[model samples]
Target chain A: MTKKQTCIFLIIVAAVIAALITGIVLTDGLYERDATIQETMQDVVLHERDKISLFGLAVNPGLISAFIVTGVILVFAAIVRIFVIPKFKLIPGKFQMLLEQAVGAFGGLARSNSPHKNGFLGAYIFAAGAYIFIGTLFELVGVPAVTAAGECVILPAPLSDINGAITLGCLSYLVILSGGIAANRLRGAGRTLKEFSLPVSMSFRMFGALLSGALVTELVYSYLALSFVLPVIVGVLFTVLHAIIQAYVLTMLTSLFYGEVSEPYVKKPKKQREKKVSSKTEVVQ
Target chain B: MPLQLAAVPLNIDWQQILLHLLNFVILFAGLWLLLYKPVRSFMQKRREHYEKMDADAEKKQAEAEKARAEYEEKLAGAEQEIASQRRAAELQAEEYGARQRREAEELAKSILAEARADAARIRAQAEKDARADVAAIVTDAVEKLALKESASTAYDQFLAAVDAQSAASKKPAKGARTEKDHD
Candidate 1:
């Protein structure tokens, strides 16, 4: 930049910093006088109820965030299908290549995992992976909203909510059970029934992973000493890490279990039971 | 773990769970329709179109190659036929030329033989005529001489000269008499 441009940029940055400091000081004074906030900013961290009143019904913050993320995803998919997908050439453009690679990878993973080869699993996994990744990073956009208590709060990631985690976990388990049943019939139900607590374990794992990031960010923001640069650093790091790790973890677990349950059990006669064991070793190899 | 779960507000909200499930299902359906189906269809069509075009081009190339090979084979056959016909024609022409040459040689030989015979006959006739003219001139000279001198004395002189000349031409007269006898 030229000297004049550099000077102007520094001036604008200084003005923005001054405005932020003034705003924070004013808000601090107002909160000190208000008895409602005198509980020493107890809600700055994890709160019991972050309820949002939508259409005269009490909805959780996680639910609204999910709705928004889903809407964004839908609009994005529509735009790509209309404006981008039609323009796909025999030789792919960057956006077209990115979409193909993403779908191909997820589909390839499912196909490679399932011994019985469920063709639909790939698409389902792609959908699930996309939702998890996007929903985890949804709150990083800092979408501000007003709660029923007239307080300003940014909506957190949808999966950070226990309810969202439970929904995803249950859905994955159902998908696995369906794959097993499709491949093995009644035997598939028996196999799936044996892993009855899978949904609970998966839900807790996801919920805990996402909530840890949120809680850390909140803890950073809650302390006056750490609210400035520290919160920004902690929040971005935690959010990005959780987005990638949680997305991979959920997708991996779902695909693995789906693959396991989808394989048909081979029938061996009594005389060939030991022979089946030898064959099993060869199959494993 | 139980204490941690209790610490967070993880109450089972059926309404929220139901809504979230509905949202995920919609997302899945939307992605499948918008992204997977269209991309797969486009790829399938493109692959089939290219494959069909390649097959057509290959088929045309094979046809053209077959036609060219047939044409080459036919051309080679025609060339071989033409070569054989030319050889036969050349051999016939050579045979005709040799026959004509032989006929010409035989005809030339007969004509030369006839010409030689005619020249010899004409030369003999001229020689005979010259000899007769000389004899007649000689008799006339003798008669004129008798008129100028005594007849008996001139006749005696001519007889004596004839006798002397006869003696000198005896070998030629003998060969002529033999040839006349043979004729």
Candidate 2:
């Protein structure tokens, strides 16, 4: 930044810190609650009373967050499809380059793994990767919704919930199974069936990784002293890191298994060739 | 038999799982239609267009090379034809020069033989005329001797006749000069 901009930034920071101190002093007992650490922990672990009803059914906060992320993604996709994509030039601009890179990365992944049958596999991985990465980042938005008990709660990352993780993991396995079936028919299905532990492993891995970030962030917020600036670093670091690592891990594993199961079956050589080989040896002798 | 299980930590709701699955499916379909398919098709089309342009350029270059080779081949053939034509003309010119020289030599030999024949005939005619003149002169001298009884006067008349015969022989020399001009 320039000298003037740096001075302005420093002044804004000081003013915001002053305002926070004043607010803390003024609102000291305004929002006080007589809840124990165990109760807070129970609320974090099981949000039974914090569920929001969607279409006459109670859904977790993470589900609402998932819907928000999905809606945003869909709207963004629509905009790109209708307006941005048509303007893409042969010589790409910055936005076009980014879009092409994202699409090409997934395409290259699918092609490298399953060269023979990667059309559907490429599309699946692209969708799955987008969902995981963006869904993880959705938690940072801190959009609050009122629960069934009229208590406002921040919607967490979607994959932090077991339902979302299990759904994605099983879906990935289904894609792999479909790839196998499409390529090698019954034999392909059998190959997928041979690795029955894939869905469970993939689900729990995603759930654990994402939940650890949520839990750590919760733990920081639970303590009043550490809630000031530490949650920012911890929350951002954990969410972003888990997003990248989990997205990569799941997509890579799915493509690998899909490729293995979809490999073309090679037939054995005929008996006539072996006989011809022996006859040639006899002739040589 | 009913078995009562202890507290399970997981809130595994089948409905929520199903809803999440449904949400992902919708997202996948929407993205496929909106983003992935169209973008990939555009790239594939661009690649094909450039490939076609490259092929056309290569084809034109090959045609140009073929045309250049043909032109060079024709030029070489034309050069060989020109050389052969020049050689034929030179050989024809030499033959014409040799034939002209041979004809000139034969004509000169015939002209020399004709001139020799003309000289020989003129000499023979001169010899005959001189013999006749001498005979007449001798007869006249004999008559004078008989008439005047003087030998000296007859001898003077004979000398004059010999001088006339010598002057007449010079006419054949003029005829030989005409023959030299004809040669």
DockQ of 2: 0.48
- For each candidate in turn, give its C-alpha RMSD to the true structure in angstroms: 7.7, 7.4
TM-score top scorer: 2
TM-score of 1: 0.72
Question: On residues A1-285, what C-alpha lDDT tens digit does candidate 2 reach at each position?
Answer: 899999999999999999998888788677565566666555555555578888877888878888888899999999999999999898889998898888899999999989999999989999999999999988888899988777888989889888899999999999999999999999999999999999999999998888878888877876767877788788887788888988889999999999999999988778878999999999999
The lDDT per prediction is 0.79, 0.86
Name the 10 consecutive residues with the lowest summed lDDT in model 1 chain B: B1-10
Interface RMSD of each: 2.0, 1.1
- Can you write out model 1's per-residue Cα lDDT over A176-281, one digit (the tens) per residue? 9998899888888789889999999999899888887877776566556677878667877777788888887888888888889888798867778888889999
The top-ranked prediction according to lDDT is 2
